[model samples]
Target chain A: MAEITLDQIIQPENMVYTRSRIMTDTVLHYCPGCGHGTVHRLLAEVIEELDLQSETIGITPVGCSVLMYNYMDIDMQEAAHGRAPALATAIKRLMSEKFVFTYQGDGDLAAIGTAETIHACNRGENITILFINNGIYGMTGGQMAPTTLPDMKASTCPYGRDVQMMGNPLKITDIVATLPGSYYVTRQSVHTPGNVRKAKKAIRKAVEYQKRNQGTCFVEIVSNCNSGWKMTPVDANQWLEENMLPFYPLGDLKVPEE
Target chain B: MGELRLMKGNEAVAEAAIRAGADGYFGYPITPQSEVMEYLMAEKPHERTGMVVLQAESELAAINMVYGGAACGKKVMTSSSSPGISLMQEGISYIAGAELPCLLVNVVRGGPGLGTIQPAQSDYFQSVKGGGHGDYRLITLAPASVQEMSDFVRLGFELAFKYRNPAMILSDGAIGQMMEKVELFDPVPRSKEILPWATTGKTPDRERNIITSLDLDPKRQEDFNLKLQKKYREIEEKEVRFEKIQCDDAEYLFVAYGTSSRVVQKAVQLARSRGIRVGLFRPITLWPFPSKEIFAMTEQVKGILSVEMSAGQMVEDIRLAVKGKIKVDYYGRMGGIIPTPDEVVEMLEKKIIGG
Candidate 1:
């Protein structure tokens, strides 16, 4: 019990973990073990690692993470539901030097904001789009989303989504990948430490391409909404691995020339 | 003195936007007001003043683009006709709620749905009362002449940023498509002043800026609304703009705005020739509605006629303004029809004078 003082132990070389300064002290409203907190942390870490803290602007969507601005210590704009890409287009064009990104959820991006997402991508706007696909509308109490898997259960579709009646789940990332304006497009997840590292690298590289003004760089994070999914946090991750991964597989859908 | 040129109202507005040092214009092509983006594209203002003019995919995207640009405290704007404006309501509400400064121009066309492309004042209620959700108001300016169409571009931005609210030039297709001589100001350079609340990027020196209308708490949202209403009252007090012609000696008054006001001005002359002492009250600012000024005219005139291109949207405001102190009557032509000055005078006689 020799007093090992705090200052002596918290040396730079010994520091293995610390919250990114890019993230504000505000507690994330995300449910415990919800992927949003992890994704938000990754985004803040990416921005911090890239040293774009002062030159970055984040556009948040209208889902569970609409309040993402409260946690990220960066200039931000909260867009109308699904219109984050359109907003990002304008912000990036007017302030081309600023690193701009839009973080959206499935309903906001793949459904109501589909046109904005497609057109912004098609125009080759130099902005990054971070999409969170949770298979259900998490904020509105687990209503069905465009990405809700067929036969999946939701509050609005409690009987489980019937493909014929509810329509097939949209593969917006795949559709976006085909667009020439998409210089880099990828699908990722943050359920595991290994996956988290991969997702962060995707975000960093996407921002890099945006800095070059290459075109639209999109990163779709296949995440879990345990609260909306009506499952425990652990079960949600296991379910995401079994059901979500097969449909929305995690991989680079599009990549610039080697 | 500025450069004088004969230009369409829409074109004049476009050129004036460049001269006003607007940072960007995002628009979609639509009848009557398509010339705005067309002119911007053809002129290549990007080369002229480094202005960013983009043809957005749709009115929805266009207004959102304005939202994004305006949140950064940039001088940005968008133009559309009635149907297109309807599509922008969602974004407009968000902009109003965020209290971001921006300009909008509605070159109105007749509409209940996909109505005619011809000029109409039917959007009067939409612009003033608001076509969007919530208790919000846009500082609306109605330009009777192409000069005002051009001039309002600058004035609209000034008022918008002054109160950090949206300003709209509520013109009709007639003024948007019609041509008239306009005196254009010299091109000013883009503003270099920092907007402390803008989301341009967070500097290490200060806290991050967030632009949003979301206040999950009812009390906080209510307080924000009360603050908004207070600003609106200030605007109503200081920004109500109008012009009175021959009102000092008038026994009757005509209250109108935009294209209808232009025709009503002529009707005033026609009514005067017929031994009727009538004056024209033209509201330049529509949302502040010129209510008090029009109400005060009740003491001078025996009656008021609210002429418009719709069945009678603005007449309701006049009725409220005059408060039954005098007869408040209405005459209008619907579906792209413009009433003749002679016909307008006759109706005034039958409606306000005798009724």
Candidate 2:
């Protein structure tokens, strides 16, 4: 073959993909192999593709992604634990022209912020909620989350989650889908390349629905917390597929009828 | 001149918020202050002035909504009574720490856990001395009449945005439920100018604006605290507002604010008729505490009588202001009872003059 140079190999036509401009140069604070980084990338890509980089407002929950405002180049507000939905509601209502969304975790959205989440969905606030459920409080040293599976080992539940004592694992996504105010409710994962593509598409749809002002759109990403789960990134993905996917099935639970 | 209308204090706050060009009002229905949202909903300020008024699920949600709206650099507010305000303290602290400007109105009611629905000044300590956590203070304005209730809404928002701090109108059920003639101001148009510092949107002209109270780094957090303290000192120096009546020649001073000030005003007149040289000092800005004026009065008065509907809460501030130069006596009714003007004067005589 003729001597090919580096510049010729980096031609625009040969370029496959690049990081979205909506994502700032600030490096993410998430742990190695954490799913939060992937979700953040998907959200940033969606915002860029929709050309909402300037008109998008994001509310970040008090969890591992609390510093998401630093990584995302968008107008952002940091909400108290579990209050992101309420904050997103007000932002969307006051500035109806802007695209508003909340990035939250299971501990934030399902545990302490349950009332706020339910009420916001019930009111049909025109906002998108991106929920990452890893079945444990990742930032707070892996305590038992509301979505923590039965027999799952957590720092608080050292003997594994006892169904009788700790009660059953909660499926907040399904509960929220039953609410009439929720126009679109879906559950997806980013464990595999195929699944990541699907989750990205779901995020784009959620944002599109938000722009149309068609009530609340909730996307629950069944992610994995490798460090919290005490597993290698690959093992964590396998564990999530085995334990979490069975409980939180991978598909749209509710969608507005065409 | 704007129109003059007879309205309740709560109704006046709602109307004044509309005229002040508030972008949104998020509130929950609490006793005494429920009329604030009721009036806003009835008038549909959303249709008239494009004000987004929503009744939140609870006071907690309402305050967070105010935080969200304020983060967008819009004029937002909420009104609640004592119990409701207690639920809002966490949100208030976060708002203060985030340094977002927003208005809050507390229509005071008896409390220590749903104590009563009647008016009480027991929350004086809670309002001015930082009801929430952290080293923070709210620019508290104690409005004594329906007119002041209307006027303070405009003033509260003005001061809130000016200092980028939360401003509170500390009224009670007495003022909130009572009605009087209020000269309404003409509606001020909402500013269309973009807020460069607000989290409106991350436009190309500026870096992204992030509204947050969290600073994990201890050094940065300490810096933020020092900055807030500096702002508070500036406010205390420039915003200490109070009214003095017959103070230059008075021998005794009655220190009060809000409804107690109204009662003390009557007592001042009654004491003067009885040949007692008594005057009233009404603090308009409670957080700034009007310490300078109260301290100056020590030069002219023999003693100061702190009258309130609470169990001598504001008396602490009066004593601090006096600096032991003169005796500051507290006279008041506990629970929700309102002392009569004669009773206040009698207590002053028994507690200070006779002593």
Q: Which ten residues in a row have the lowest lDDT in candidate 1 chain B?
A: B185-194
Candidate 2, B39: how far from true, in Å?
A: 0.4
Cα error, residue A24 of model 1, in Å, equals 1.1
- Predicted candidate 1 versus true structure: per-residue lDDT over B188-299, tens digit per residue: 9999777999998899899899999999999999999999999999999999999998899999998888899889989999999989999999999988888999989988
Q: Which ranges in model 2 have alpha carbons more than 4 Å from their true place?
A: A1-13
lDDT of 1 by residue, A1-258 (tens): 899999999899999988898889999899989999998888888888889988998899999999999999999999999999989999998989999999999999999999999999998999999999999999889999999999999999999999999899999999999998989999999998999999999988998888788899999999999999989999999999999999999999999996
* Per-model TM values vs. the true structure: 0.98, 0.98
Model 1 TM-score is 0.98
State, as a TM-score between 0 and 1, how close model 2 is to the true structure. Answer: 0.98
Model 2 chain B worst lDDT window (10 residues): B189-198
The list of candidate 1 runs beyond 4 A from truth reads A1-13
- What would you estimate as the lDDT of candidate 1? 0.94
Q: What does candidate 2's lDDT look like per residue over A1-258, in tens digits?
A: 999999999999998899888888988888888999999999999999889988999999988999999998999999999999888888888889999999999999999999999999999999999999999999999999999999999999999999999988889999999998999999999999999999999999999998667789999999999999999999999999999999889999899788
